[model samples]
Target chain A: MITTSALQVRFGDTTALHPLDLDLPGERIYGLLGRNGAGKTTLLSVLAGFRKPSAGAVLFDGAPVFENVRSTSRICLIRDDGMVGDGTDNLRDVLDMAAMLRPAFDSGYAAELLDRFGLTRKQRLGALSRGQRSAFAIVVGLASRAPLTMFDEAHLGMDAANRQLFHDELLRDYLAHPRTFVLSTHLIEEQSPLFEQVLILHEGRLLLQSDLDELRERGVSVTGPAQVVDDFVYGLKVLSERTLGPTKQVTVFGGLDDERRALAGRYALELGPVAVQDLFIHLTGGVP
Target chain B: MRRFPIARFLLSTHLPFLVMVLAGSYLLVAVILGVAVLVSGPASVSAVDVAGQVLHWLAVGYGYGAPALLATVVVHGRTRREFVAQHPVYQLVAAVVLAALITGVYAAEAALYSAAGWTQAMQPDRPFAAGDYPMIFLANVSMLSIALVTGSFAGVAVYRRDGAGALALVPAAGLLVYGGAVHGFFSLPFAQQGLPMAVTLPAVAAGWVLLWACAREVPLGNRVPA
Candidate 1:
């Protein structure tokens, strides 16, 4: 488990993270959703002992994490740029260094990942394309097998097929070796299926944390005739709306009570589930 | 708990490459000097006379290598403290190894000069006289050791503070000057051949302390996408 008590981070005059408290239980897959500059990277950097919190304490299983070898050695945070090796180094050199420093690093698994990603050990890190570099970062992150592994925008340059391969590999590996996995990404709908719980951040603050299903249930989409859809969503928390010819679809927060459900049934309006992406857009101040 | 794991890892990974480069550089310099001697008549200076150039190259190498190595090791789950503690061991070993190689080049050059009936003249400012291999090794080791530590300090300073961190080079220059003065590179009034350890040891120690201060709490910056 990881716990933060009044954790804060400030850079010059700008506060990156406010004094916030959180308790994150271990051995679960968590999706950290945030808009750009929402403090997601700062939080993960502190958690991984990459940086010190400006104030308060971050503890891993009741032990402080910053500069604590016992704690840091068990944590791995892979940022977008990989941070695995120098440009001059070859892929094999990086893997060797990782194997030497990280006790849990699985060399065989790393080799398999290299082959799966169509990367040769002899290729220099600087020679790989941006997408290949991201894939290589994923391979290192997964092969490290650290108890607490986090990836902050680590799939930025990957193509759709590579992203799918990464997600599949992540799920398969998690099943084989259960551990704490925190992924911070902008690909909400595609990645939400793997998240057991979701933590949403808005403006340097954690806006919400809940089970993924429960969070998804907080909003409903209504579709019918334009007039009826507007009337049905009247006085409700309307997040967003779209119209096409004579039909309209309006998404609103809060569950529909029985009377509203009956009203929707009587009006022949169709109700559907809202996507996590929609809720994220709405909760994060609606379309930039 | 592992003993100097960072040091061992760094040495094992980088030393072989460094040695190869050093050998290649030595061979290239020897060829150039030999050609010069053949074309211009008996050469006054031996190839090892210019071995001091290695000091600058080593400093540059450490300046660029330290931060990258630190990031790689820290991201791999090693603490900054472990890196700070173990890196000096690698630096010291590298300095010793490089000094020994330079001294060997001196021996090789002495033999070549003898065979060719050329004078193996050395610069007047150097700490060692011609044919004095022991003093040559000791003096080179002291200067190279200081250069390595100072380079690391400057590297970490730049890494932590970006543009403004270049100010560290001022102090780094001061340290290097002191190393040279004591090692007889600069003809200082107080420079004595056998008394260099008095200042050389302290300068190296001070460089290491500065390096630790700059690196201990340094935050790793996020790398921009390529």
Candidate 2:
């Protein structure tokens, strides 16, 4: 179990992560999505114990994680560029060191992942392709089996097909072993289904961190006569509204109640579910 | 009982030892080969003489590489920055302890050479100046200081989000200045062993080291290299 309480991360004059609290427990996927500079990486760093929060603290199983080897050794963080081992380009040496340092390291799984990705253990990482390097990072994160694992931009340099493969492999591994997995990505549409909870960061602040299913339920477009739709939204929180021909469609925050659904049915108003991307666009106020 | 011993975590960082040992051995081997092939005039040297030269200078150069190698091993890990912040005091102490080991080994050898006439047959007059003998000591201290500075600098720089570039550049930059100054002003004539030079230069190395160390105040995790 892992939790961050009032964690604030600042770099130089820019505050990368605003004060926020979060809980990521065992055996589920948590998806983190944000616009550029939304502090997703900063938040993950705190949780993984690779960074200390300017304020607040991250706890693992009721113990503070910062500078605690027991806590950190149990967490694996896979970054976008695949970390270089103290600036050394010897990929095998890095892997060997990782295998040596990490108690739970699954050498077989790491080797298998490397093989599946068509990467030789002997090839120097500097000479490898970007996708291969990202693949190497993914292999380390997954195979390390650190109780709490996060993949930040793990999909970097991955082709569409390879991305899908990574997703499938990650889910399979998680289901079989059942540990924490936080996936941060810009390709939200492809990965949203894999997350039970979604965190949307906005400008160093958490605009939203809640259930993905609840978020999905919040996105309903009700279409009807302009006057009828307007009347229906009188007491509801509207996210967006548009008109087509003589009809109007309004998106609202709360799901329609039984009474409202009945009214829409009787008045011949159409109500349909909107996908996560559109919901995200509404939540972050960013263009879809 | 505390989960990880300071000694264990301290020792775990020296995995680079294997790599460095191999490098040091290769360098020693090349030196032996070069000396054997080239250190000849009207007559060639004997095996014992060759061994004497190789072991002597190696004992001499051991201090130079020891400190840097120890620091490189001590202040290194999965990431450069993590290596430093994990145990700043512990790492420094370990590097100094390893430096002492290199010197201790050489001191023991120096005593053995003096007690026994083994080296006398090879050369009644050693091939080094009196100043050169002390230079080994200077080399050890400066090398260790230089290593700690450069290693710490690289670690701190990597924390600033330019880890790869900084790691590559830190050693080169530090050595460029240190080596340049040593070559130029190390043993200038007509002075009290350039007392100010020794004091000021090591201080400069320490200053460069502390500057990056101040930068080491950064907080980052594996998820965020920054």
Candidate 3:
């Protein structure tokens, strides 16, 4: 398990991440959702011990992680731009180096992932296309088999088909070996199904942390005559609204209890589950 | 084994390459000089001393190679953190290893010169006969160690200061003054192998300490304070 207590990151006067606390249980998949500059990457870096926090501590199993060989060796952070190797390094060299450095690394599995990604072992990573680089990074992250692995916008360069392939490979690998995985991505709708829990960040502060299903359940949209919709959403939390002629649709917080459902039925109004993407946009002020 | 992975990685990866390049370049120069002497005769090659040429090249190699190697490993994503974690001790070990390698190469060059019956024109004023090679090797190794450590210090200064022009000039100016002193001092008729060690070892120790200070607060990705 990883626990962060009052962690903060600041670059000069600009606060990248405000003081925040988080506890990540092991053997689970966490989806870290945020728009641009939402402190997702900063938080992940701090956890991985790649960047030191300005204040507070990040502990793994009750011990500090930064500069601790025992802790950092078990954590892996894969960035999207491929930060690990130089241009002259081939996939084979990279895998060999990883095997030597990462205690839990599996060479056979790494070879399998190389083949699955259609990357030749002898090919230089610098020569690969952007999508190929992303695939190679994903392969390294999965193959390292670190107990705590974090991926920060790791699939932004991949195409749709490759992205799907990555998701499939990730799920398959996680089922095979249970570990902590924190995936920070903006593709909320496409990846939310794989998340057991979700953490939302807005403007350098955490907005919410809840179960995936519970977060979705918290949003409900009511559509009906303009006056009825306005009256029903009144005295409740309204996220967004749209109007057409005499009709209105308002997305709001709080699940509809049976009484409100019956009231909707009596008013001849339509109710629907809010899309996770729409809910994210509403919460983050349409940053994405 | 796990305690000093930075030192191990650097020794495994960078040292071998540097050694190969140094030895190969020296041998190539030696072979070319041998061929030219054979073609033109010993009198024509009177001014061209192969042993002195090799020492000159070795000096150049350590002065530049040490800094480049450190910069490359420190910026690399895989090795940077470990490099920082195991710092001053790693550099001390690196200095000794690099010096030993250069000394070994010089020994091989001397043996090859003796077997080939090549004339060593620029004889030292010190007691440096074939039997006294160890003393001569120690003297040369001390100078090279000083050069390498100084270069490593300048490299970290440049890294911490974000490649500022002033810090980049540190290595160039240092090398110039040191090289000038080596030339001027050794040109004296009474110079011996013992004096250079006195100057070189203290400079090396100071340089190592400065390098540690320069590297203490360096963040990942070589970021400077805003």
Candidate 4:
């Protein structure tokens, strides 16, 4: 398990991550969802031990992660913007280095991943297209086989087809190996299917964390006559609502009890699940 | 088969450049020696001149290149989010290996010069004599080690600090190297006026300490080099 206590990160006078405690268990895929500047990358960087926290402790399996070689060696943080060094190294060199340093690194697996990604080993990382670089990074991250693997906005320049390819490979490899994976991304709807749990960050603070199944169950939408919907949703947390003449559809932010379902049926109201994306936007006020 | 072998990785990553510098410096010095030998006979190209010139060129090149090499490692390590502090030893190991390789080459060249019956030019204020091969090699190693370590320190200094900060510290570092060189501190094993190992070794240790201190301060974020 990885946990932080009052973990705060500050860059100059600006606090990138406010003090907050967090716990991340093993053998699960965690979707870290946040808008731009919501501190997703900063939080991941701290967890990777890349930067020291300004005010708290980050521990991995009961030991501090910062500067602890044994722990860090077991963790791999892959960022789409860049990885390891200046992107002057050839893909072959990068893989060779990873093969050397990473304990569980599978060279054969890396080779296969490169082929699957349509990336040649001889291509220099600097010369590769943006999408190719992202694929290359994913190849490294997956093949590293580190116990804790985190990818920070790693789909930046990928086309839709490539993005889906990555998601499939990630899930396939993840299920085969069963290691901890944290993916920070803006493509919430596309990636939400793979998440066992979701952590939502808003303005440098953790807004919510819940099981994916549980959170999906929480966002219940009720649609019926405008007067009936208003009466049903009254005194409840209404996340969002849309009105079209006499018809009204309201998305509320909590699960309904059997009694509430009976009441909805009695009023001829329709019930449906609100997509996680809409809930995210409603919670973070991202759309507004 | 070894996991990482960081020191080996450091060495291999840099071997090509080191070899290039060694070959380039050797060719330049060899040409100068060849010209002198052709014009004034082999007797004109003394053992001291050959050894001293080789040391000068090789040391200067390695010294200048050491920081660039270290910056590459340090920055890459940072980007990987690796614990750079624990790995500074890789740079130290690289420096020692570099000193040994260059010194070994210098020794071979000196032996060839000696066999050719070249006169001793007695440059670098250190006069060479029969059976002083060990002392000459030791002196060269010390000089190269000092150069590499100090260069590493300068690199870390520039990496951790901004333009004004790095510039402000350069003069002091320049003075220290100049003062040590002029006073025969660096030519320790061969010169009559040389400082003892007791002092010189500690000086080298101080350089390592400074390098480590500066290395620990290198932020693990992308900072464009100015």
Number of the top lDDT candidate: 1
Please give the distance, in angstroms, between residue A164's alpha carbon in candidate 2 and its true position after superposition: 1.6
Candidate numbers, best DockQ first, in rank order: 1, 3, 4, 2
lDDT, candidate 4, B1-226, per-residue tens: 3634555566676556666766576667677777777897875434334445445334434544433444333322222223233234554455456555555655666677778876544455543333465555455555555555566566556655555347625642753454245324344342454442444465567766666665554545543211
CAPRI-wise, candidate 2 is incorrect
Interface RMSD of each: 1.3, 7.2, 6.4, 5.5
For residue A237, give model 1's deviation from the true position in Å: 2.5
Score every model by TM-score: 0.95, 0.66, 0.78, 0.77
Clashing residue pairs in candidate 1 (N, C-alpha, C atoms within 3 angstroms): none
Q: Could you say which candidate leads in DockQ?
A: 1
lDDT of 3: 0.69
lDDT of 1 at A107: 98
lDDT of candidate 3 at residue A105, scale 0 to 100: 82
Winner on DockQ (1 vs 4): 1
Candidates' C-alpha lDDT:
0.86, 0.62, 0.69, 0.70
Tell me the chain A TM-score of model 3: 0.88
Q: Can you tell me which runs of candidate 3 are displaced by over 4 Å?
A: A221-254, A259-273, B1-3, B30-118, B122-132, B161-200, B222-226
When summed lDDT is taken over every stretch of 10 residues in candidate 4 chain B, the lowest stretch is B74-83
lDDT of 2 by residue, B94-167 (tens): 44554454444445444544554323122322222222435434434444444444544544554456454455
Give the higher-TM-score candidate: 3 or 4.
3
Q: What TM-score does prediction 1 earn?
A: 0.95
Candidate 3's residue-wise lDDT over A154-212, tens digit each? 88677898889888988999999999899998888888888999999877898998888
TM-score (2 decimals) of chain A in model 2: 0.84
Q: Candidate 2 on A1-288: residue-level lDDT in tens?
A: 988888888777888887788777778898898888888888887776656688988898888876566677787877776764544446676666566667787888888888887788778866767787788778878888877888889878878877877888898899888898989998888999899998888888888877888888886888899998898778877777889888998887768889988988998989987567767777787564
Ordering by lDDT: 1, 4, 3, 2
Top model number, TM-score: 1
* Arranged by TM-score, best first: 1, 3, 4, 2
